[model samples]
Target: MVAPGLRRYPVTMRLLILIALLNLPIDVAAAEDRRVFFGTWGTAKQCAREPIKPGGTFLAEPYEIGDEWLRQGQLWCLLSWGPIEKRPDGYFSGAHARCGEDTVRQYFLGMVLSDGELTLRWGFPASSGPLRQCPRS
Candidate 1:
């Protein structure tokens, strides 16, 4: 009841399944490693002063790990869905799209230093200071 050329189909499928299973852990580990921005980030200084106050605190949650981006939210508002890239100087830079604003789609850049300081700049005013990482609940 089996074709001559199709006899190896089951074995081939099994081998493919096994290979995919073996790669699962590596994929998961990579995702875990990309979760560097997950958690609450806070700063006493204002990060924006143009359209609205950037607030004293912001949280970065895992959104699309495959895209290497986080869902950045401020107090009671979603700020940006942006990508955070690591620099060679141990600093992380992120360009985020400000949410709930004009159709102009202004992009803001934020840099987090090794000492937990964050520098954010957009259009007019900019903010920079030490940012404290909030304890996760």
Candidate 2:
């Protein structure tokens, strides 16, 4: 004979489970901007006050502030990375990050994917670590 108490126990558990599932999601949208730690393996710091510390993860704003490089006289050599939204045609549009009164935007060519790190690059990509996901709350 089945135990009388066991029958009620299963029903009670099911009722509690249903209530929790009905609550559903309560969080920020997926498109919301979030600050996260930007990870990189190799770095070039000839101009930065302190060279970007490698190995250990460093905190950065949600936006991507490309490396600042000024050419002697009148040349520009800058490198930056941002979220890439790939389209059906394989083309992508980068969300332009604004700073002060200027705009931070770049055209991405390709990304170097490895076991660790993702290097976002345009044209011929240089050797750099890949951009990993580190969403900070």
Candidate 3:
């Protein structure tokens, strides 16, 4: 039985429509937001101040990534980091190189934001929790 004013789509057309709907992408902006790992991240006390001290002894871990480099200390050239790459597992990995000292080769696993808290997963299963982004001065 067909409605008076409604026309039925062919089975092939209906299948195409279903396929198109299934292949349609979710929110692209939201997906991109999840992948953002820029800016400085630290603990409560660390991020409490407007400008985080560059070389604070109290901070056990300092994580900062800029446009081209990842820094551990306040000084830019002190610690070296290679180009970071996003892995297939949705984690960023980079080589922490300390050139000209002992030629040490360290690595940064990745970082992710969950519920506004940024977590840095780097080395030996150690992850920083409840780290917030510091306000840029």
Best by TM-score: 3
State residue 95's C-alpha deviation in candidate 1, in Å.
1.2
TM-score of each: 0.39, 0.24, 0.45
What is the C-alpha lDDT profile of model 3 across 1-137, one tens digit per residue?
88654554576688899887865553343334333666787775665542446675455445675544556555342333333444454434343433233454555545555555666666648866667777765
Give candidate 3 regions above 4 Å deviation.
Answer: 1-35, 49-62, 74-101
Tens-place lDDT per residue, model 2, 1-137, is 88999889989999999877764432122122211222222322312213235553442222233333212112233533344343343323232222221544443334444454445444454433444443332
Per-residue lDDT of candidate 1, residues 63-112 (tens digit): 21123332344212234434445676545645554444344354564645
Clashing residue pairs in candidate 2, if any?
117-130, 118-130, 118-131, 119-130
Measured over all alpha carbons after superposition, the RMSD of each candidate to the real structure, in angstroms, is: 8.5, 15.8, 13.2
Please give the CA lDDT of all the candidate structures.
Answer: 0.48, 0.37, 0.54
Ranked candidates (TM-score, high to low): 3, 1, 2
Clash pairs, candidate 1, are: none
Global CA lDDT of candidate 2, please? 0.37
Kindly provide the TM-score of model 2 when superposed on the true structure, using C-alpha atoms. Answer: 0.24
Answer with 1 or 2, whichever has the higher lDDT. Answer: 1
Which window of ten consecutive residues has the lowest lDDT sum in model 1? Answer: 44-53
Candidate 2: list runs displaced more than 4 Å.
1-108
